[model samples]
Target chain A: MPPFKDLFKGKQKYVTVKPTSIQTEQPDGLWTKCTQCGQLTYTRELAHNLLVCHKCGFHFKLSAAQRLAITLDEGSFVEFDSNLVSADPIEFPGYAAKLEKTRQATGLEEAVVTGQGTIGGYPVMIGVMDFSFIGASMGSVVGEKVARLFERATRQHVPVVMFCASGGARMQEGVLSLMQMAKTSAACARLSEAGVLYVSVLTNPTTAGVLASFASLGDIIIAEPGALVGFTGQRVIEETIRQKLPPGFQSAEFVLEHGMIDMIVERRDMKKTLASLLALHERRHEAG
Target chain B: MINLTLDFEKPLVELEKRIEELRNFSREKEIDLSEEIATLEKKAEMLRREIFDNLTPWQRVQIARHPRRPTTLDYIGLIFDDFIELHGDRVFRDDGAIVGGIASLGGRPVTVVGTQKGRDTKENLARNFGMPHPEGYRKALRLMKQAEKFHRPVVSFVDVVGAYPGVEAEERGQGQIIARNIEQISRLATCIVVVITGEGGSGGALAIGVGDRLLMLENAYFSVISPEGCAAILWKDGSRAQEAADVLKLTAPDMKRLGIVDEVLPEPLGAAHKDREGMARIIKDALIRSIDELSGIPPRRLVERRYVRLRRIGEFMIREAAQEGFAEAASAGGDVLRATGPAGPKGEAKR
Candidate 1:
């Protein structure tokens, strides 16, 4: 058999730019390069445009705080289960150290932050995944937080809005991380049965286990423009198939053509879209 | 018989090879070496049986992924009759990774679906190495629902590492399709028999895995993630897969013991690859028997039983101290929380 490296020699086609902590830290007075277009723009200008590239319309990854600040009504967010953190039951080597480092680097308790917030003054449950927090991988904590968020939302009679931005299951927790896909999915199943509206906003790079779970179970699914949403990595698929991928295979536009997502809303218009949806659902609930 | 022999089966392969060499030499020389050849054959057979009987979890995983192993289509051809394959997820193009159709298993009509990995490189590419996309899953669900409507039993052969992890698959609601399949399959008004034919990895496997009676081939493995994925996550090294396999308890025997699988259908002599016909017979008999047994029950009861079966898997005892600590904390906070006003903590109404 040929060497493994020989099979995938020149197949790394997609250029994924890993956003640094420094780029996300201040969000002002700095120049950031658009991963898709390679055009640099002032950070303050990017923030004013909701971190979307002015030139090529590329959507940058958002932190959980930034997502909540933009989507939710002012000062209306009430977080739930904030203290829940993974205990690393498998005792994975360097897992504790890595979690500590990520915590310090991102200033977040876990990859996902779940809470109750008002979207256009309509009660809704929100769970936002921060891509900067260890690639926003779903571990037990992320799963539990999302599950509990849905449970609370169901009891309180509110719609759910989740911003999905993940790089699959967290590896540190091993099988525990994988099980989260099922656990969170089961919770979403219950929420669906309860007749609660779930609007899943697929941000840049939502793939693997999370994509297979609650992220896909939305009543009204939306995505940011040019966001990469898929289960397998592009490079892995190319290597396995030994073929060239079509242009924009995993992008939001490609997904829309495939009829996976309902619509692609720009970052600046995301709040308006979500608010309109919330109001529409509120009217339905009142009449029904 | 195949050239793809595993590490543990090296001795058996070598002995078999020697026996073949002696047979060829005897035929060429026109000499009487039949007695010696017979003795060597007996020894080889014994060695093969012994080695197969004591396989470790990692070895079973290897056998499950063996290139020569009979795949879903192979089993369908051998065991079932009139397999008319249905294609395409109505909303999108058909996915070749997962194949399903109406077929007759032992003269009983059933809807059959399974992940199809390729034998050669070309076929593997076409089938996406049996890692299904959202359309693949949606296709399976559609066929299952069709079976449900027709009051036919459903039998799915599982052999996938997981769902496809591509950007297109995710955009197409891969997770939602799989999760919905699980939810809908559980409540389907028909007997469902799931046969774990090969690698049953994670949610990808479980997407089409729900059934009243779950059967597994002796060498088949089912786990949340592949051993390599687990090793990479835990040890930061993919080489620790063997250790991960041992700890994951993903082998058929382990699954049977853990109540994840109803029965373990024993493979012939050296494993499924050595005797595809024999393996097919065993699987066919198991599926027919399980379906017959399940057919007598009402649809509601079968659905309830399936729910219980899934809920019971991976159930374990949490640490007593942790349980008590959590309960105590909850009780301590419950009173104060109840005493608070109707207004929420952040000044929002409680609704």
Candidate 2:
């Protein structure tokens, strides 16, 4: 619940001159004001409750694992491409070492974790993007892993549900990372063409090249209660065009009301809804 | 009663608080609150149904655009197998809007393409609200070509609002890209099937709109321009978009009647959002049959049929127009020319 003032300033953890890993050890007491109620809360408590604030009912940043555990059936997830990693295809200065450090710290090979699991007893494929990993950027490896998951699901003829949490395309991969968006989307398209049900779940803070590509092509789109959903951040968009956002702009529920998604699923109901849809799709196999 | 509590211990506490408050109030022996609670519950259910059933076109637009509405990623999990995502337009930058790759469609090898929108804020910033830039169109054209080359049928799920209109998109030649997609897809030597799965507005929709058989979901609307854009131009106001939508005949029934769409797939009683599986099956059937029909067509016939379809599109319009006023113009012109002894000025004849 840090004030968006710092985010507005774009104070990122970029070390342009140093190629070493920025292990930002806690510089201050790991607690701050709630984004909703301005109540001071401990960071670890929020982390334990899946980034959801206890007092003000505010949701904070969620790790990919936290998202998967919340979404999948109890102990049913099996991760795919856990070893697949991202390379600095763009050669952005200091990006590769930064990626390595983030990789080690997050214990995730790539930004996305493709999991095969049951949500409400229905067999489905789920991919959760971890923003902790390079802003949960979409890269070639992420795309490939996603595409492979799609292929697997298509072969299995089951439904796919992706939880997208990204900062758009990974700049470190340069055009290669950008290509991941199209590639991943193409894989989703194949799933759709094959008559397999594919639904995209947009999570908190999805943006950039990833949104432009495949994040929106869902059979039944779902978003977390208060996730930010838009093409650009408010500040950057304002700076670029010097225009103010309409009231309630870019929130998940607002986007839903605006006709962008199907439902604003609570953190709890996502799995059950997914399972019911999958089971129904299985019974109603009308494809040639 | 079955426990409605699934997760979030806090909500349970809040509900319990309300329940205790109600019990205490009712236990006073003077007032019976159970009836009020039941009435309120009934009212809530009725309101939910009314809201779900009576969604306006604008509200439907919102539903079609709900941020949480599942995206292509969700579908891949529900469907598809071993999807090897291909990259690059083979000529320029890869466009994120047009997603294309190889995968099995109901156990058959097929090339797939879809326009993707983002779910959260950062991804939407990246995906550009599911609008394909020129590069996105080019990428689709390449995928269609690959499908044709391999004799694999192509299935495209189109849901873009339109091509990106940014300076970057213009600089990348948006018009040329759209024109080229029209040209290539019209003559692409593969059985192409397109589904207007969602918005399907403008060229972003048409980039994938060309196909041997075009299908649209009941709740899905496809049009030459968005209703708002259409209204703004036709009525000089954007608010009349709903009327424009009704008259423009941009719905599935309208498009089907106009022969612009091959089939109007039915959703559930409410909408596809209510019955995602039902809608998926409708699409799957349309895709499978269209692919079956287009797959066995000879390469020459495949391209020829498409060309013929395009060439034949305006036959009714041309014929109808000819009958309505062209005949009178021809007759009048003949008389005028004869009266002038066939030596009239060329510019005067045009008038």
Candidate 3:
């Protein structure tokens, strides 16, 4: 078994922590309740469905490696900047220790894993963010990796696909974390100028700084079914506006309805969907 | 009286109130409390120093967001003369959260931009609590572009919690505008100076915050997220914001040490709220110094320097070993010399 699956074995931190509420905690073990539709799901069966509950089509968070496995062709991922670790720029208290704990738990040096991979024989650059790693916050290393991924993809004359699953910008890194939003967005702008097809796949809980920048700058934005995507939390907005938000206000369906995202693809069809996008782009390239 | 004193400043507030009461009593009763008042005044001054000097990161945050703290318009009014306020983004309705205009600073024509917040609840709603929408950023960028075109320096005041997260703001692409500002501002072919007069939260602060010389007031804060947000996300408890602030290192001194800020402009004795004009004068001097130093450089050189300054932000590996004197001194010294050595002017001379 892959380390990612093993990481989930006998422990399920992902299921317990929902983005919307701190009070909501799922019961431990094989049985889990979906926060969205409140469906009782068998954990094993849910994993087989790419962590999506079959009853409600709510996507569960996946580790970066798990995402790469499902999206890329077999044995195609060649990870870049794997050893680029984070530094305590401000020597932020307990940050290094917290980072070490997360590294041990997730087997990721940073929140994001950037690599070159093939999807249905189409070569591309890919980055997958693991929400398990410190809520997949974009710090300096994540920014550097994502920026490098785009630069490499543009240079290689191939498409780019990124799986975004973040809580927000990493607060521990202070201003450095916020700078990533600009850095990644600027990198995306360069990629756009190069005329490369960039597909951003928003997973469960893409919010704040990541959602406000490159995640929203994709040539084609695709969100997993029921993925939460927004610049800020519902609670924060509600506090500001002093009104109750609509149900699923920042959900994938809501974003699609609001014309922010291009489409919502299920886990079962994501690989095929990406392959078709690559093929279409190739045909367009030829025609042009 | 309705006092909005911070937790740490409560003792000082009490001292001041006692002093006030004693003064009134002395005036009304014709009693001599001069000796008592002198003693209390000295104690109050010392207490103020102690409290401010040893302020925790969270305390600094409170001061930065103080209700009486001078806002962008206050700074503009005090620093620049003959200001002509500009409006509208042209692409969308003018976002009042951010206000900018052409202004004169020490006889030099420059463009000034800043995030505007309100003093009270009604005005806060009108300005979106100083949180700008996409149009706000676009308007600032438009003004900045105009500054670049006219060969005028751009000065911006950064004081925001974050970009507005309203449904309308998101629908209009808030992310794109902030992102574009950072990108364009980095390559803008003119001198740029940014002053953080208050809260500098996340990309909202960063949108108009990047410049050749980023100056932050003594009590100002610039962070990726509000301490409350950080606390809520990290500890699952927003009440632990004080603890989060300590860990965030968002204070101006912390930012200066990290090279995120070029300089830390001194605020008044109590805070910026105590003396607005004094704080503004310090900011004006810093801006003038930055502009004068940068104005002589060619546009291309200015842009390159700004790019290098931004690119050099944040810390990474190899500091520990170097600090331990693991590397040879000769090589390290040579590397620093090479890195800081001037290349542009000498190359031109050679050509």
Best by TM-score: 3
Which docking band does candidate 2 fall into? incorrect
lDDT of 1: 0.76
Off by over 4 Å in 1: A1-58, A87-97, A100-107, A172-179, A241-248, A283-288, B20-46, B54-58, B77-97, B104-108, B118-135, B161-183, B201-204, B223-250, B253-263, B292-351
- The whole-model lDDT of each prediction reads 0.76, 0.62, 0.77
TM-score of chain B of each: 0.90, 0.74, 0.89
Candidate 3, lDDT over the whole model:
0.77
| lDDT of candidate 1 at residue B127, scale 0 to 100 | 94
Model 2 TM-score, all chains together: 0.45
Per-residue lDDT value at A129 in model 1? 87
Candidate 2 chain A worst ten-residue window by lDDT: A10-19
Q: What lDDT is reached at residue A1 by model 1?
A: 15
lDDT score at residue A219, model 3, on the 0-100 scale: 88
Worst 10 residues of 3 chain B by lDDT: B342-351
Candidate DockQ scores, in order: 0.11, 0.01, 0.12
lDDT accuracy of residue B293 in candidate 1: 96
Ranking by TM-score: 3, 1, 2
Candidate 2 lDDT by residue in tens digits, B6-77: 222234345456666777788886688988767655555565566555555554554555555556544544
Ranking by DockQ: 3, 1, 2
Sliding window of 10 residues with minimal summed lDDT for model 3 chain A: A1-10
Off by over 4 Å in 3: A1-56, A89-97, A154-158, A193-197, A272-288, B1-44, B171-177, B234-236, B316-351
TM-score for each model: 0.76, 0.45, 0.81
Question: Of models 1 and 2, which has the larger TM-score?
Answer: 1
